[model samples]
Structure formats: structure tokens, C-alpha cells
Target: MQETVLFVDDEKSYLAYTTSIFENKGLRILTASSAMEALEIIDQEHVSVVVSDNEMPGMRGLELLAKIKELSPHTVKIMMTGSADLSTALAAINSGEVFRFVVKPWKKSEMLRAVKDGIRRHRILQSLAREDEYILHSLAQTIELKDASTRGHCDRVATLALKIAAELHISVDRQREIKYGSWLHDCGKIGVPEAILNAERALTPKEFDVIKKHTIWGCDVVRKANLSKTVQDIVLYHHERWDGKGYPCGLKGEDTPLEAQIVAVADVCDALTMDRPYRKGLCRDEFLRTIVEMQGTNLAPHLVDTLLQILERD
Candidate 1:
């Protein structure tokens, strides 16, 4: 998506020249005369690679790069400086912020090569992210096989959560996190015993306590896998309730991340509508009434409302 490269420099002439040099190289070019302006572009646009001149009016290139890292950690950052001091290069490297450091009055070939390398690195990261997503989906399916009753539960929850996220106008990156998190939300069930999961009888208090540990277990699994913080939160907090009475952490209301909240609604809806070992599945009208009754207590009111609208539409 970041087929665009952003050039940041105080010198308008320099930005124009850089754009001209790269215009025909099959790259979309974006420019800004100040770091603040560049930040605006970065926020508003999908910038794959950023090349910034070190000495800008307000914010230095290194400082701008740091902010950009927070805003879009995957965007490749390249620093250019005419001074090209040893300390500056060391600082950029030490901060782990720069993909490439170029001396000012750059050769055309050298600059082109660095930009190409940055683009290549960005594409590699994108590919790796896709692979990670595939692995997460497979893991979810494997976890489902542990309990026959919940065979397609993860996929259903993911589909419903994604629809809710889209209706809420969540960003694409966050939507991806929601999808991954939904699939992996129940992964901690792997730690539970088969007899307990498959038991047709209602769980005793002690057994229910064991069930609560699944959230923490899921969080541990996600942590060891080095997943994103959003995914970890979902794995741990998807059981949290709006009224602060839920399990594992009992996080209440907005304290739970919005993504987790969205997944929670999906989980509840799916569980209510699907047959469990002990109970019959609810019909569509009953499921809708149950979801509406949960608003402001068991579920986030806005999310419950969004889910109801989605159900009605479908």
C-alpha cells in the first residue's frame, strides 16, 4: 500500500529536485517543506518510505523520524545530512530509527539505490505480516479441534468482529489486529482438560474457575509468540464486561480496549446462538433479544447496538 515515498526538507527547491529525479522510477512522490507538514502527510497518507533532510526549521530529521516511528512503525526512514557528523550517524543508529543514512549532495545512483532498498525492506515486512496472519488462523483452527462443539466458533467470531470493526470505521491495521485476535481469543482453551471442555453437565464453581484461567493462558501464549500488544490485549481481555463483573481481569467499560470489546460481543453472540453440550441453540429472535438485554452490562452499549444492526442487516 505504501507505494508512495515522502521527502521532507525545508528547502522547497531540494524537494522539487528530488521529486523530479524519482518521478519516472515507478514510485509515487510526496513532499513537505517542514517536519510538521511532513507528519500531516504521513498521517493522512500511506507512506512506505520516508527520506528527510537532517536540518529542518523546527524539528530535526532524527526527531521527526522518532515521531514517525510511533505513528507508523513499519515505514522505512532514511536520513540525509550535509554535515554528516559521526555523532549524528551514531545517534540515528543508536536510536534504531534509521533504515539508511545518506551524506548530503548525494549521488543520483546512491540515493536511488537506498530508496529501492527501503522499499524492498517494507515489502518484506508486509509479506512476513501476511504469513503471521496465516499462522494465527491455522493455530485457531487447531485449537478448535480440541472441542468438537466449537469447531467453527473462531472463524464465526472473526467474521462477526470484522463486520463490527468495519461498521465502526476502524482503520485497516486495527481491523487486521481484530481479525487475528478474534481467531486466537480462545486459544488458551488448549490448556484446559478435554474432559472438562467436553463435559455435558453444567460446570461447578471449581470447574468454572479453571475456565477463567483460559484468558491468562491465552495471554501467555500470545506473549511467547511475540504478537502485537493489541492481539495480546484481546487474548486476555475479551472476556471483560461493561459492568466490571467478568473473569481473569474483570476490566470494566472503556477500560477494556475497543478491539477486545468488539470481539467480546461477537463471542457472546456466537456462543448464544450455537448449541453447547448441555444447552440447545437459541433461535434468531431469542439471540437478538438476549444481545439487546446485554447492552450496558455484559456488553459495551455501542458495540451491542452495532452488532444488533449487523444481525438485522444479515
Candidate 2:
């Protein structure tokens, strides 16, 4: 519950001034006069919020905050500068690199409020992330009970999707979102009835119509849970075919989100390996052949190739 804020600036006066303002506010205040020095401090301690000056020598504040993102993604970033530019501020906020952009000659009230908001945001995000871990698996488990055949399907799909994402060199944060998305891609199926889901015979078009509504329902569930857009997209769009022939929406190739495409490939890979009431599971070689053939048809070709390369290496 102890919150720490690091202030980075080139001027010793600004560092002292900021520290004086917050020292008695019941918050831990740490300061560094240069961007390099701030990074050193960050490397050794947990920083809850970072208030950085933009014009520091050797490394700019925006660049430093970018590094902070890699070092501690949950840390809130605030950019302060004397020479505030519209373009830089807009881009940083848009890209989620900066939580607040404060002018150097900020009023005491402004600085205090910005830091307060930053801390609150950081706490909320951290709390949600912590709590959502159980929520995701609980939902996945409940979804699995709809059909005994899919007991561990979500975990298997998530593992394969993560591997494909890694092969594509995705950033750590994005990969985390991909993992969440993969785990809940079929979450909407929770709304479907067990009779249809566990049917021994092939599905009728009307029954399939009821089945396809899972994406729509699943997306709604994720949205209400306050998940990232990346997670919601995967849940809704993973069922979309690469050529646009498959799905509730019939989204065409490349039109679908990349994360969704990656999961779709993973879904097919795992689904083919699992025995259904109607058909036996495919052998590894047969599965590989089927995936290769599905390239650019039912699944994205690039992701399919990425999965193939990963499999080959293993």
C-alpha cells in the first residue's frame, strides 16, 4: 500500500522543489537529476509512478518512459517539460506512454492532482490484473463444462497461440493480452446449451446458427469485464475465416485482427488433435498437412507459417 513516485529532472532546484511538495503528503518521494540516474534508481527499486522531465541530456523523457514501460509496465508515467509541444504530447498519450503531460511551470495543485490520478490509475490496473487471473480460469472452466470433449481446450489453445505470438516477436505486454484472448476465445459458448454442444450427431444449420452466437456473447462478456481491446477482438474474431467464408460475421482475409488470426490457427491445431463425438482426432502428420492446406483459406497464411516454423524447430 506504500506508493513511490520518482521525479527525473536535470535541475537540482526542480528535484528539491518537487520533493518538498510531496514529502509530507504521506508518499515516498525519490528523485534523480538526470534521466540516466533515474533509470539506475528504477533498476534497484519498485517505482509506482514516474514524473520525468523531457529535455534531459543523454536521454529524453519520452525515451526513458519507454524503457520504464519495458522495466515495469504497471508503473504510471508522467511527462513534464518546459517546452511542451502538441505533437509529442498527443502521440505519447495516444500510444499510452504518458499518463499525464505537465508543463514545467505547473501550479502546485496541478502537479499534486496529476500524481494522485496516476497513482489511482496504477492501483486500479494492478488490482484488476491480479483479480482477473482467477476470473479468466474460472470462466474457462465453466465454459469447458458445457461439453466434456473440450475440458482442456482453452489452455491448449492459449499455449499454442502464445508460441505463435513469440515466433512473431510480439512485445511482452501484447503477448500477455494474446494469452488472455486465447484462453477466452470460446467463452461465449457458455451461453449455448449443453444438449447442442454435446450432440452426438452432426449439427443442423439452425443449431449451428445458435452455436455461432457465442462470439457475440463472449465479446460482450469480455467487454463488461473491462478487458483490453486486444482480448475482446480475439474472442469475437477468432471464429472468422481468413478468406471470410467462416464465422458469424464472415470477415475476410487480413480484415480480421492479427491476434484473432493467430488464435484461429491455434484453435484448428488443437481442435484437429482432439476427438469429437463425430470424428476421431488427426495424427500429428495429418494435422500438419491440414494446417498447411488451410493456409490463406480458413486461417491466415503468415500465422500458419509461423506455427509451422515453431513446430519444426521443436
Candidate 3:
């Protein structure tokens, strides 16, 4: 999304003047007559930078910016007032609410410089986020290349899991974490021998033990990266069953984190639907029947029902 700025000032003349200066400069501007109005716009739109006049009626600039810090913490805030009070400026800076303070009758060059600097800060943050996503997707594709597995296994799992998470009414932040977990659920397989991963025959008892250790290895890998705990849980526990017979950790029932449980169902669904070296993939009708019978045994019963709701809808 492009970086956008909002101007909140009680005086119509100043609001117009602030917006006019940035016109034809590739800057998108939104204006509000009061602090409350500014907040309403913020709630509905993505405002990258907010320049507000402090002495407004109803809600003041500092109070509105404080609320913005809680609501959209990354948005850059600038305090504008005709009077220059060091105390107010200091308070805004110390609280980490305002990025810059501008005096009234400001030089056009000074305001422009401040706004551009704020935009640069926002762009840096956005670029880092994109880089993180690229690294995750690249890592997932590399993992898939190790074994003769389904095409884009991690991507499919993430798509399916996110649909179920949405159906479960999970919060948006958690949904993002779920996506990350889905992509790296089997990351531990990086340590497993390729020969064991591609074996046509059922794994021997000792071989299965090595396979089970992949979860531990993957969790350790994720932990070292300092990822969120939710990501670690999904990597560590995606194989865990609803019954007390999973692996590494035989967590039963709700003992498994919800994010892990969602990814677990998604992983199994993909494995059954896609062709493997040992067996042909199941048709939709057959797969549905088998998984229906598997509810409460191999997977969480409620989560299985949730998955069914998403699949049937699609």
C-alpha cells in the first residue's frame, strides 16, 4: 500500500494550507476538522502519517495521538500548534507518540522535509516485512524439493489452514502467525536423511523414530530464529493427535495449541489428497469418507468439523 498522510486541524485555513503544500508531490493527503474526526478516519483508513493541531476542542492532539499509538502503533504522528511549548513537545517525544513537532507559520521546506522523513521510516518497516515473507516462502519451497512430495505442499497447507482459521473467527494477528507456522510446520525435515524421506516401503520402527524427531529438530530451528511462540508450537506439534498417541509430545485434547491443531488438520488433508510414492492420492469422495471416520481419533473432532465446513463451502 502507498504511504498516506492525514492532517487534523480545527482551523479550515491551516488544514487547506497544509494539504496544498504537499499537492503534486506524490503525497496522498486526508484532512479532518477535529481530533475526533481524525480518529474516525484512522479507524477506517490506513494513515501512514498524522499531523494534528494540539489545541483542538473536544479531543486534543496528544490524546488522539496516544490512542493512535495503541490502535495503529506504527503510524507516524506530528504535533502542530501555533504556540511552541517545550514541555508539550518533550512529553509527546518521551511517550513515544509523536515523531516530530512543527511550529505554526512553519517554513514550507521544513514541513516537507519532516513529512518525507516520516515516509522513509514507514517504507523501511514495510520493506523488512516483505523480506521476511520472501525468506519464509523460499525456505518452504526448498524443503519441498528434498522429497518427491506434492507440488507446493507448504503453500497448499497455508491456504487451507487460513480458510479454517477465518471460519473459526480467529483474530487477524493470530491468523498471520498461523500462516507462518503452516509454511514451516515440517521445517525439521531439513535434518532428516533424504533416503528415509523417499522410502517406498513403510518405515521400520527405528526409522520411524528418526522421522518423529523431525518435529523436535524443526522446533529448535524455529526457536533459534526468535520467531513467535505460536510458530514454534505449530512446528513442534503439528503431528500431535487428538488422542494421546501423537509423537515426541503426546499432547491430547486441547493440550495442543489451537494454531498447531489447525495446521495439523491441513497437513493431513494435503497428504491424503496428493499422490505419494507409496500410494495413489484419494479422490475427493473417498478422502471425505475416510477423514469423517478419522474424526476424534487422528484429528480434533471440532476442528475436523470446521475444516469440513470450509471445504464444503469451497
Backbone clashes in each candidate structure, one number apiece?
0, 0, 0
Model 3 segments more than 4 A misplaced: 1-123
Write model 3 residue lDDT over 119-179, tens digit each, in one string: 9877876577578889988888898899867558899999999999888877555677789
Candidate-wise lDDT, in order: 0.88, 0.87, 0.86
Q: How close is candidate 3 to the true structure, as a TM-score?
A: 0.65
| TM-score ranking of the models | 1, 2, 3
| Model 3 lowest lDDT segment of ten | 67-76
Residue-level lDDT tens digits of model 2 in 1-314: 68889999998898889999997788999999888888777766678899998988899999999988765667899999775475797689999889988986888999999999999998997897878878898889888988999899999999999999788866556677788888899999988988889898999999999999999999999999878778889999998998889887899998898888889999999999999977889999999888889998998888888988888898
Q: Say which candidate scores most in lDDT.
A: 1
Per-residue C-alpha lDDT of model 1 across residues 59-139, encoded as one tens digit per residue: 998899988875565789999887647578677877688988788788888889999999999999788988887888999
User: Which of 1 and 3 is the better model by TM-score?
Assistant: 1
> TM-scores across all candidates?
0.83, 0.71, 0.65
What TM-score number comes out for model 2?
0.71
**Highest TM-score model number:** 1
User: Which pairs of residues collide in candidate 2?
Assistant: none
